[model samples]
Structure formats: structure tokens, C-alpha cells
Target chain A: MHLDKEALDAHESRWRAQLINAVAGFKPVNLIGTIDDQGRTNLAIITSVVHLGANPPLLGMVIRPSPKGVERHTLNNILDTGAFSVNAVTEDMVPQAHQTSARYSGETSEFEATGLTPRWIDGRREPFVAESPLQIGLSLLEHLPLKHNGTHFIIGNIDCIDIPDNAVADDGTVDLGALRLVTACGLDTYHSVGSGTRFAYAKPDQPPRPI
Target chain B: MHLDKEALDAHESRWRAQLINAVAGFKPVNLIGTIDDQGRTNLAIITSVVHLGANPPLLGMVIRPSPKGVERHTLNNILDTGAFSVNAVTEDMVPQAHQTSARYSGETSEFEATGLTPRWIDGRREPFVAESPLQIGLSLLEHLPLKHNGTHFIIGNIDCIDIPDNAVADDGTVDLGALRLVTACGLDTYHSVGSGTRFAYAKPDQPPRPI
Candidate 1:
């Protein structure tokens, strides 16, 4: 199949969304937990998380603009509180995580609606998903607007991380496959990954070898 | 395991990179292809591609700063030509794709070094990886600097795409697992995903149902 910009623009909105989303391949599926100043919590499944850097432990995610007259709780809460939690969506949490995307009212928390537990650490304002095997607390660093599209690119600085001890290797690599971390492709599909192969550091003169 | 920012900051750089990278979960693995003004092609393995928007078909990727006195070929090529290709990495292409990360001299194209074919479409400046099952051509749209970590966030507008027709479903979702698309975690690990479940659009009053 060949699709040009014109062909893509001509596609039905939902269809185009699915195709475009899948073209990026497997994405990190996470439930972003946030809270408004009124203490009402919000949970939204996000698949756009991208690793930005390691030194400052930065990650970036794209948040679509809220519909006219609608409030995007996740963005608004992050802006209001400067803190949020990214909880890795595992196979067991797929249904609950996917359910969070439903249009719940501002008064209704997705955590409550979907029956997912909200975990709050001491001194933290954001709530984390207790069902998640890996939880990362982050502070909002920058919110850049992409003018081409009204989407906001939110960059966060990792403040802390909670993970199972068995999941982390001595070399510091997290065994995502062993942890059964779920990944998403299109807007609605969720996948489980197999224990992957790790290659040794590539060198100009050597063949790629598994480490 | 729980790691605070202070503890993370105290870890060795490479170890920290691995841990932080893996914490984001599975990532889309692709070979980014670019060409300099002088027609020297460069291919590098990239795992940071994120879907920015669907209508405009925008994708964003992070490029780390080059070492002092070193020219980052891929970043420079994209800037010099305003064109690039993102080719999805598949299970069969993993070894060659990984080999592209080897630090080759400016004149050595990774395509040639790894024996992967560079395919050209008429009028397109960027070369696509022929071995890749999915190929996307993108024109540089924005080059934003991430001030926090000195990384460059390059946003591109999809110009064209070439993919296998059988891989696309009627609903516009691409069957990534069936296509055997490869995903990555940490720095060197590559994974194959299982055919996942696709849930129907969520509704406030309904449980998520597989489509």
C-alpha cells in the first residue's frame, strides 16, 4: 500500500488516526495519573511517551488538544500541579487501562470508574496506579506547543521510580519482557512482547552478537 | 526497587541510561535514513519515534547532542536536506539495523557497511531501507531544541508511506505483530510482539470489548 499526504488527508478521521498511529510501531502504553487542585484524580491511557534524555532523565509525550469547550484533565492537572505519574500498563491492567479512555466527567475519576487503585506516596501530590508493576513520578519540565497541530508536547523530568527488584538487571536494564509490560500499536490494540535479544555494543568491524 | 532522583544521579552514566531508557517501556524501533547535501547517505537506528498527530501525520524524534568536535551525521543530514525516511525495524532486519549504530566514518554509509539495500523513490532525497516492511518518508517540519538536556526534538510531516497491503486491517489498524515488527527497550534489546487484542472504542457505561 502506498499513501501520500493527500491520500492520508482524505481518509476518514478515525481511520486515518489508526493508520497514522500504527505507522509509528509499538509504543509504550502507560496510564498517566494526575490530580486537580480540588483533589479530584484523573487517569488517562497514553501511548506517545518518548525517551528524551538520560542525564536529566527526561521523557516526552504528546497530548492532543482538548475539544473546544472541553477540559483535558491530564494536561490541565499537570500544569496546575507540576507533577504526574506514568504507570506502565501491563497485560493484566489492559482492560482497566483501556477503560480510562472513556469520557468520564470531571467529577468522576477514571480510577474510580474503572476500579483501579490509586496509590499516593508521602509528599507527592500525584496518584500512581497500584496495579502497575513500574511506576514513575515526574515533574513537568516544559510544555511546548506544536503549531502545525494543536497538540502539546509535555516533557517531564523523572523524579523517582518504583519497580520490582527482580525486574532490574545488575547492569541496570529493566527486563520489560519478563515484567510482561504491555505495548500498544494503533489507538486500541495492546500487545505482549517476548523476551527480546540484547546485542553487544556495535563496533565497526564486528558482526552483531547477542550479549 | 525504588530510585529517587538523588540515587539515580549517583549511578554510573551507562547504567543510568539503560535503566531510564527501559523505564519508558517498549519503543518503536526504526532505522532513520538521511542524506547530506553532497549525497552521502546515513542510516542510524532510532527508538524514540513518537506519534504527534494524525491529521497532519506528524512524528517527533529525539537526537542527542554530538560529542565535542564530532559531527552527528544523521542530525546534520536532516537539517541540510530537510528530508528523511523512517523504516520500521522487523525481526529479520534487527541485526543489520543494530549494525547501523556502529560509528562509521562520514563517508561510509551504514547501508553499504551492513549490506542493506538503499532504495530510492523518484524525486525523494532520502533513501529507504529496502529490507524494511514499512517505509515512511517525512519532510522536516520543526527542529526544536530541548533546553533541559541539550537534545534536539525533530518533528516531521509525513509525506508518503509504503507498506504491505496485507498488514493493514479494514479498520485501518496495521497488524504490527503479524508483520513481525520489532520493538526495543533500554539501548540494545530488541523484542518481537505477539498479536494483541484490539478493544472497541470505549464508552462511559460499557466495559471494554475486544473488536
Candidate 2:
């Protein structure tokens, strides 16, 4: 059956908590970002993260519709400054990282909310969460607009990466199983990455697999 | 250490992508619309799509950084029509769905790109791809400013969804394992839902695991 925009919008706006909460929970490593506000930095864990494109490297996160109807700090900071950090959360820092979501006054910093130390590098002023084994620095690519409701889709151009040395496999693919990344289910529900049985398939043009 | 915006944007603009790519692959199915000057509908599939929000139901897609930049039909369509569809890619029609990505003329419709049909209801001019097990309509959200060299971010408010009955598990979760969804790895690599072992965890206050 066919669905229209008005119908889909109503279903989405109403069942959102149930829909997103369910699907997002299946993925591994909920995304966390660090935004620089004024001079201090703010941190928030985002399960609403997705990989968009690789060439020229891009990543995206949906900031919930704020009640104020303006823009979320993360979106604004990235736009104002043109950069932000997207870090993967670990099973190790799950509790602490989640705390970044606690509601605080605009002036309050999430770093203080969770007491998670920020890692600093000599050449870069932006900080990566010391606890996260994996992280990346994303340059602001675009601030996309959702004309109907004042929502903006922010695209970041990925530049560098930091992976725990041991997690790297021989093929250059970072073995996520070894990293022990965590995935979020519905609200407040978290799960460890499940066992993965890898099976490869060939194109139809290629001969059928030897079963 | 709180990093400055200049430092953050520069680092994040280039790095961090290596990790997200390590895991999240191309698996999503999107309903892309391209209406020609004649107002005929041209729909296509986008496996590389992401959501931008819940409050406003924002959606995003990473289109190939167009060479001409002006030859964009989707961008122009949204600007003119103010809507599009973020259709979910399911296994039932993965083969036909993937075909929508094949290059087509500016005047041709992706609806015809694959054998799949675009379903439409009354009044709303935009149609949904009938085969998309789970499809949603989105109104024009926003077109973000691309910060660096090239590329843009498109955000849209979800207007509707056509979720199939079989896809939803009893618990209201999408049983991807049962659906056997496929994913895209480096470049052209496609993988199916592999091994899965789910574990449940109780609250911290609960007594330690019975030793």
C-alpha cells in the first residue's frame, strides 16, 4: 500500500520514541560527540548517529527537535566553529558516557557532569574522550535544512582517526568484536555487541557458492 | 582538555571516518524522487541514507558530490516540491531495489529504473515505492552549507511510513536477523545479516551474578 507525506509524518512524530528506540538499539557503539561552546567543551552521547559517505568522508547525527525552536548547541557549535568530534562509546565507559545526557544549565559543561577526562594532543586543540578507544575529528561539511520544521542535517568531513593499537586486524579492518563496542536498544537499554558469524557472498555473475 | 573550534573543525574534518566506516556499511534503502520539467515522477533507491532527527523527523542522504553541482535533480526537486521519501531497504526486494541506483537520464524516472512500482495515494503528488517494506515521506527540511571543498547535507521532516506487517516482531522491534537485511562494505562489497547472539542484562543494583 502507498503512504503519503502527511500520513507518514503523523506516524513518525507520534511513534518516534518507539521506532528509533527500537532500531537504534541494534547497532554497535553508540556515537558520542564533543562540541566546543565558547571556551569550554560539551559532550553528549548520540545513538542517533549514522555513516553517510566515505569519499571525502562524511558522518551525520540527528539533534532532537529542541523545545525552544531555535537549534541545539551541538548543531550551532559545529556551524559556528565549523568542526566537531564524533567518538564511539565503549562498554567500558558506558555508564560515564551516558551521563553526558543529563540536563544541565546552558552554562554547565558535560565534562563536569560525568567527570570523564578529555584527552588533548599537542597539535590539536580539540579533545577526545580519554576513555573512548576509538574517535574521529570531523570538519563541518554542511548544515542541511528540513524546511518544514527548522531541522538541520549536519555533515562532517572526517579527517583523522585514533584506534586502540591492539584492535587492528591484519586486513586493516578494526575488529569491532575485539573493541567491545556497545549498542543501544530503546531508551535506557544497552547491550554488548553480539557474536557475529561472518559469511561472504559473490555476485550473481560469479558461480554459486560451493555448498 | 577542551579544544578550540579551529582545531576541532580541522581535525574532525579529515579524521575519524576510518572507524565509522570500519563498522557501518551501506545497507539502507531510500526512495529518491526526480521530477522532470514535465512534472513526471522519477524515483530511485538510496542505500546510503541516514536520519537527521525525531522531534521533526529529519532525514539525510549523502549524494555523490556532483561534478556540475547544479545538475542535481533531487536537490532541485526538494527545493521545488518540498518533499521526498526515506524508504527502508528490506530483503524481500533487495535485488530490484539496488537496481534503482543505476545511473539514469535526468528525464527518466527511477520508478522505471527497476521493475519495482511506486505506489501513490490521493492528493499527495509524491508517491511511495510499494516494495519498501518500511517507507516514510519527508517534507523539505533544510540544505546545510558544505564547509570544506564540496558536497552538501540534505535534511527532511518525515511525513509518513508504510511498514510491512512481517517486519515488526512481537516486541515492537525490527527483527533484522529474520529479515536478512544486506549491507554494503568497502566500495561495492555487500554483506547480509550475519551471526547474532543476544544477551540481556539487569540493573546494577541486582545482586551479582549467582556464583
Candidate 3:
């Protein structure tokens, strides 16, 4: 149906419902804190993920006001450490990545709850997910706050990545199709990106024939 | 790339380059505005467009900081009337949209800029782009202030969408691919999506297999 006024409202409600349901389908990710001494480890499941830029390897996510009351473990930890890892939640690591969202004693580690091993880098205290297809460690760069939503824009500098060799394509582009890129629709439903069809367009300089 | 620290930096930079190059390839979009009572019109080029949420059918973009401080034509117009239209820029309307971005006399009717017509809605008092692949007129639901970026988020409840019959697929999906969707990479580059190469993935309960 055409998206008229009434239809638009229904589409919006449906879309939001799908997003909430689809978060479960998203491959859970480990937001590893990349910090120095005194930095804390905080992990969370990231369903809304996007590629903002490639040159700087910049990616962005909207961090809503967590129930943790301003002292959000992930956001706070990122600010303290100025570094965090966007660990791809694979079919294998979903459980652990999700456990990271649980409410535990501030000192409790999700890594323990999920039984996932943490890989550390020399000279850097931040840990990376051992099972992720790609692990990107980034440094905090800027914040874009959402006043109405009580969300913050947390921009970061990509410092490192841990991508498996087999997932790379022959061409320069990434072969995410082979990796079964998981997509999040809203809250909990998770869906692996299905067969994606592609189409190309010609130049703007060329005019189209009369319809 | 293994995406070590150095590789991460390179990736970010490269993606930035790709984004800028992508937008430069296409025409611009027309960000249409209207002032009622006197029935004045304003239009501008909005290459800095963003898609906020899919579920709620939310749209967001960076509007120029109003010279009169918070008296923004777009934001105020949207807030006052609770409506606005995001008109996609096309080769035919680039000149008008571009000129609308310039310092035009406050009385100038941008709707009159390109000799193009704005299809006015009776109750909403806003207009839609008859030629847009998607012309959505939305009612304001929320407005957020970005303290750090000096930008505001004017989220509207999408009230209507006027899509071409040929652009929609049978399954209720807007087949922009069929219409040759043009996208901006970064600051300037524009590119058409490549041909569809279907890549499939399995469900959660099933063993991971290629579709």
C-alpha cells in the first residue's frame, strides 16, 4: 500500500517492532575497552552498527542512555580509556557478547560469565575478542549528543583490526557475504543478511528515454 | 589487510576518500521549506543528508545554523508547523536547490526558483516533490539539540510517501535498485550501486551454510 498518513504510522510502528525483535538476530559484539592503566573493561551488545568512513576506518553507533545512570560502563570506560574495540559478534561468540550486557557487580567481568577468552595486545591493556571475524580497536575522537534522546555520539579513531584471512575478497572490497553479516532490525531480533541483490546505475550525464 | 594499528588508520582514511568521491558523482537534492500565512517558500541543496531510523521511518540532516540564532528556516518551520519535506536532489533541480542555499532575499520564493511545482497538502500546509523517488511529508515528533555539534535533530513522524509504482517491488520493498539509487560517498563523490550479487546466509538453528 502507498504510505499515506495512516499507512505511514502503521509502517513506523511495524518497523520499530521489527527492529526490537531483530536485535536478537544481530551477532553479538564485544565492545572491548582500549585504555591504559586505571581503565576499566566494559562490554555490551551492539545491534545498531554502521560504517561512517573507511579512510580513517571510522564507524559510528548510537549509544542510548543506558539504565546504568550516566555512569554507563561502556561509555564511561571508553572515555576513561579513550579506546574501545568493536568486536564482531559471530555465531560462536553471541552468548558471551550478550552476557556483557548483564547487570553485575561493577567489578564483575562478562568475559567470565560467557566463558570467552580475551586476547590482549602488548603495550596496550585493552582486550580483543578471540572469536570475532573482525575486531576493530578505536580511540575516542568526538561526541555528537542527542538531546532529545539522551544519547551521545561517540566517534572513535580506528587503531587496529583483527580480520580472518579467508573472509577477504580477491578484490579490495570486503567479502562480508561470506562472513554472514548479521543485521539488527530493532531491539532483540537478529537476522543474518540473506541473499542480497545488487544493481548498478549509469552516469547522470546521460539522459533517460521517455517513459 | 590484517588491520593492525597502522592498517586501521589506512582503512579509515581510504573510506573517507571513497565517501567524498562517491557524492561528487551525482546531482544534489532539494530540501524544500514553506512559510504559511504569507505563503512564502524556501528550498536548498542538502547533500549532507542522513537516514536516522528505519522502523519509525525517521529522517535527519544538518541544517545550517540560522544566522538569527535559533530562528532557522528549516528547524523553525518544522517546529512551528510540525511538518517538512525532504526532497531528493536530481540533475534537473540542482540549480534551484543550490541557489536556495545561497543568501536569497527573505521574501524570495524558492518554489519559484526552478519553475518547478510543489504539490501542497491541504491539512499539513507542506509540499512534496512530485518528481522525487520518495517524497515524504512528516509531522514533527521530537527535536533534539546536539550540544557538542551545534546542530539540532528534527525528527518527524513520516505522514506520507509518494513513490513511483515502478520503483516498488512485489514484496513491499522499495526497489531503489530498479530505479538506480544514487548515493553520496563523502563530501563530493556520488556513485550508483553495482549490480546485485545475491549472497545468502543460514538461520540460527541451522548449521551455517551458504544459501
Q: Give the best candidate by lDDT.
A: 1
Tell me the lDDT of candidate 3. Answer: 0.50
**What tens-digit string does per-residue lDDT give for candidate 3 at A150-176?**
666676666666666675433233444
What's the DockQ for every one of the candidates? 0.86, 0.17, 0.12
TM-score of each: 0.98, 0.65, 0.55
Give lDDT for model 1: 0.91
Higher-DockQ candidate among 1 and 3?
Answer: 1
Compose the digit string of candidate 3's lDDT tens values, residues B1-211. 3556554344444453443222111222336555645567665545434444545555554454643563366666666777787665444443444445444555665666555577776676787665555566777777766443355655565566666777544434343434443433223222333333221232223332221
> What is the per-residue lDDT of model 1 for residues B133-206, given as tens digits with 9 covering 90 to 100?
89999999999988887889999999999999999888788998988998999899999899899898898999
Among the numbered candidates, top TM-score falls to 1
By descending lDDT, how would the candidates be arranged?
Answer: 1, 2, 3
Highest DockQ scorer: 1
Q: Distance (Å) between predicted and true CA of B117, model 3?
A: 16
Better of 2 and 3 by TM-score: 2
How many Å off is the CA of B130 in candidate 1?
0.7
For A103-186, candidate 2 gives per-residue lDDT tens digits of 555576666667777776665546677777676777777665655655555667666667676765444445565566665544
Residue A37 in candidate 1, Cα distance off native in Å: 0.6
RMSD of each: 1.1, 6.9, 9.1
Task: Compute the DockQ of candidate 3.
Answer: 0.12
